[model samples]
Target: MTKGKIKVSSDNIFPIIKKFLYSDHEIFLRELVSNAIDASKKLQSLETMGKFKGEIGDLTIVVELDKDAKTLTIKDRGVGMDEQEVERYINDIALSGAEEFVSKYKDKADTANLIGHFGLGFYSSFMVADNVEIVTKSHKKSAKAVKWTCDGSPNYTLVDNDRKERGTDIILHISDESKEFLEEFRIRELLVKYCKFLPVKIQFGTNEETVKDKDGNPVKDKDDKEKKITTPNIINNTSPAWKKQPSKLKDEDYKSFYRELYPMNFEEPLFQIHLNVDFPFNLTGILYFPKLKNKIEVQKDKIQLYANQVFVTDSVEGIVPEFLTLLHGVLDSPDIPLNISRSYLQSDARVKQISGHIT
Candidate 1:
């Protein structure tokens, strides 16, 4: 049943990866969505710094639903892909795409440069869908538009697609088994749960409302100028507490931001630590000590890690000390290698260095 090259390995790699690496399946969505956020963040940074003289439009990620087609699409108005990028980014499933993206834009963590670091993030769609397609056009007008198709296997097809914009639209054809992903409410809840403070705007659907006329009366007429409003729930916060300098941010600002992060969470953060260091490696974050009642179960992805203000991972053990897992808040460190493993960190000097730095 097994095909090709007899895939040599001492340990049962497949089972090991399935069980160990994928400790959390829902993490796939987190990874994929965060990658989109990263992409959007990069574009925003480029536009802000005047490096790329382009219209700085609404930086948002779109999640479209096609019930009939059984597909879910997460589109971003950020850096798109050209032919060469498509081939280099999608076709060859490299493990360090995220690393490359980060290295290229260390300061920008400013661009989605970190998202592609671990080619593994995009593949998260497979955890919820059967097939995934990436339709993109580079920010450069001269760049060629490209499309990539994959069906949950190593084999993938790269072709040219018709695209008019300089962004990416990733469509996931939902598998028969993963229909829960199609639920709008479920998707929204997930977005709010994991991507609340992500550094990009995220749009889900549209909404209709009555607008007041000059007479201050509700106008529901079909010809009314306030027709169909693009109902977009802002999914991310571009400038979060962790991104800015500690001196610039006030105590009230931190408390306000914390409430924004956790509304239902009643108890205030026991204490807050503002982390910002650029030397040995770029890192900036704010760790919050949310009240710990009775030996918390060691929440999986508590400390959200971001590169260049873009969400990279919630699993921050690599950069965050293990003891700090009990805390909650954002940890924006551009150093923690993409999907860095605990075992690898045990031997990695950077991890040790970072651990020593954390208070």
Candidate 2:
């Protein structure tokens, strides 16, 4: 057996990819959903260019599980990649190429954009999966479908495949060590924590469950009378409360949504500010000020910022004003770069301007 030429300059990137400064292992949800959202936006751009005349149906991303098979799939009806696109985007994830892409699009790209600022989202898959496959067909009708498979190493195979649809389906061969990714409850929690307000619809489970009785309560099944029947609570909210117009919404609606977001914290929010600025990309949001104990740490569970309604992170110290860290509740914005460090923000004036608006 012969080992082929190494693509990138660094063989040491895996350590950073698997376990870096990222304190939370759940960021994989944000990365994958962001990829889906990016694909959806690309499709929208194509529609405007008269590339795809087909009606742009609902841009919803779905996660399905095969517990018995120990598999997980993320399906997106967005701008899928053709064979060449797969080669360009999937097969080669060199950090140098990422830097080049940033340079090529820098002038026109939005500073707050979420195009793998850390250049590590794709690699995050290797953190959990032993094998990952990308089945994608570009939005272009004539583009050839490509199936890219990788085994958590430098090597990958990109071959032609058949897919009548115009999107991507990422099937993860769940590793025994990472079987938790296949759990509905775990994925649901991650989605609620990270993707509650994503611009695209993310359906995790069934739409309806019959276990709940007609009285809107869980009913004990005749066969299982000894146990109270459990009903499924659909976790992801495609159309988050922040996305709606504040004028059209009632005060109670915001409060209810807040409760849905932070159920553990029962205390009422001090005040809620709905942010619906549309000039610089589609950023819409609401910021709530939950009551904080004076003795608590200044950064104790601060505002959770969302990109395109997808929950980014609660440690939004640099994105929000320094003063705002004392507050709590949702801060959904598509522009806030979730992964970028404060050192980067200091150099970028636009990011600083966005931070100024946090107060």
Candidate 3:
């Protein structure tokens, strides 16, 4: 194992990553899980493109919390990184596109001042954890597993790991200030909020379901004790409404998806719009009109913005037209830059085009 300092022009990058990008520190869970999904999806894409010849077995992302160890681990059966990739992607933050972003936006005083910018997805883990470790093995047959460890500082250590799996595991040692993330309920809630619509299936814990008897009643033992079975708790929908063809979806399907998007809301939507456009820029999603009881007060931030099925943000003002904030739904596009603030979106040509299309 060799220890080295992360290559960066500015020493302020780590502090900015931990302090600035988001107001809610729990967003670290969303960013880490989202990156795992991206890695898994990239591997699947490679296999589909005839580049990878290995089995894409069980691409489910597993979030395991160990209270005794005071650690949280995110495991994925996706495309893992070798030693060099660990250095290039994790160690060298500047080359990974964070340098330019920090250089431009690091001077911002408050978290509220930043918007639409989320280039610090992986680094967000540092917000909640004092130390983070990554164990990864590439998909190549001859590849060896490697482990990368980093503290909140620029110093990091990389070493060989004996892991036999072809994926990655991110282990985070919870800090004293971020112990809330170790709670099962908090983690579950965050998973439902941010990762419910992710393309990859995420497993957190085990769920219990009552067993049924032959007569369709609850199964009981000789003493009339109810029988139950434990099953894997899969958190996300591998295929969401936006990724499907509009023709293939029915009114009920759209309604069901709306409920999936907003689980707390009970009011049925008055109408819905399925957005699918490719000419100007790739965008697809469903927008719903809730019954406002003829009230002029419209709810904002109800709409969720996604980048290729990964939830980006709820603040869609910069991309969506001002008048359309009345409607609630989802808008997903790959063309939208993932690392810019809301103000940047206004000046961005692609965002302007997307806003025009929405108009």
Model 3: per-residue lDDT, tens digit, 142-220? 9999999888888888999999999999999999998998899999999988778787789999999999968899998
Give the alpha carbon lDDT tens digit for every residue of 93-129 in model 1. Answer: 4455456765766675354334445565665567777
**Candidate 3, which ten residues in sequence have the lowest lDDT sum?**
108-117
lDDT for residue 350 in candidate 3, whole number 0-100: 89
User: Which parts of model 3 have CA positions greater than 4 angstroms off?
Assistant: 1-10, 94-120, 213-215, 338-346
Give the worst 10-residue stretch by lDDT in candidate 1.
Answer: 338-347
**Model 2 segments beyond 4 Å from truth?**
1-10, 19-23, 94-119, 210-234, 265-267, 276-284, 290-299, 319-326, 333-356
lDDT of 1: 0.69
Off by over 4 Å in 1: 1-21, 41-56, 95-98, 101-113, 207-230, 269-271, 288-328, 337-348
| TM-scores for every candidate against the unseen true structure | 0.73, 0.75, 0.85
* Ordered list by lDDT, greatest first: 3, 1, 2
TM-score-based ranking, best first? 3, 2, 1
Tens-place lDDT digits, model 2, residues 264-355: 87888988888777665455667787776767567646576555455555666566766667666666554554444211123255567666
Instruction: Note the Cα lDDT for every prediction shown.
Output: 0.69, 0.68, 0.79
TM-score of candidate 3 to 2 decimals = 0.85
Which candidate gets the maximum TM-score versus the true structure?
A: 3
